[model samples]
Target: MLPGRTWTRLLVCLTCGGVACSDDSQGGHARAHYQETDHPVAGTLEPRSTWRWCYVHRRTV
Candidate 1:
């Protein structure tokens, strides 16, 4: 991957919302995948902080 191309993709991701993004620059060889959750999940105890809940996403590159 060239530095210029990488920077371009990064700029695009920043300009657009970073919550969800798709990367197909690898020409079917490599792709970026993301999963989003509406609310944070806690299996057991919940945090006492007011800003505890947040959106989360997992990506495979």
Candidate 2:
């Protein structure tokens, strides 16, 4: 986490286990990680939020 930022919108890459912030967050690191690595899927890291997104399909999976 950054200096004063919370982990409200964190995501973890399913293909590589890389963690990043969502697009709505400071750096949009999740999308960047997908673009850079061509990893197709990521999932929410929130405690009770269970969802996954496919970058290739551009939808929830």
Candidate 3:
């Protein structure tokens, strides 16, 4: 991990396969990526986390 980029939760962009840290971390890299690319959805990188979030609809899909 990069300095000052500690993260407990990670998210992977479904649209472009971009991986980033979740909002629970120092920087909301996932959300930032969504804002920049409008990727719409991302799934958690946590083990056994079979869930995804839709950034546009603001809910799980």
Report the C-alpha lDDT of model 3 over 1-61, residue by residue, as the tens digit: 7786688788999989999988778888999999999999999988888889998998999
Query: How do the residues 1-61 of candidate 1 rate in per-residue lDDT, one tens digit apiece?
Result: 5444432122112222332212333321112311222332211122443221122433211
> Worst ten-residue run, lDDT, model 3?
1-10
User: What C-alpha lDDT do the candidate models reach, one value each?
Assistant: 0.24, 0.89, 0.90
Instruction: Using TM-score, give the best candidate's number.
Output: 3
Backbone clashes in each candidate structure, one number apiece? 0, 0, 0
For all predicted structures, in order, the TM-scores are 0.16, 0.82, 0.84
- lDDT of residue 29 for candidate 3: 91
Worst 10 residues of 1 by lDDT: 7-16
Q: Candidate 3 has what TM-score?
A: 0.84
Residue 37 lDDT, candidate 3, scale 0-100: 94
Q: Give Cα distance to truth, residue 21, candidate 3, Å.
A: 0.2
Per residue, candidate 2 scores C-alpha lDDT tens digits across 1-61 of 6688754588999998999998888778999999999999999988888799999999999
Q: Cα lDDT for residue 12, model 3?
A: 96
RMSD of each: 13.4, 1.8, 1.5
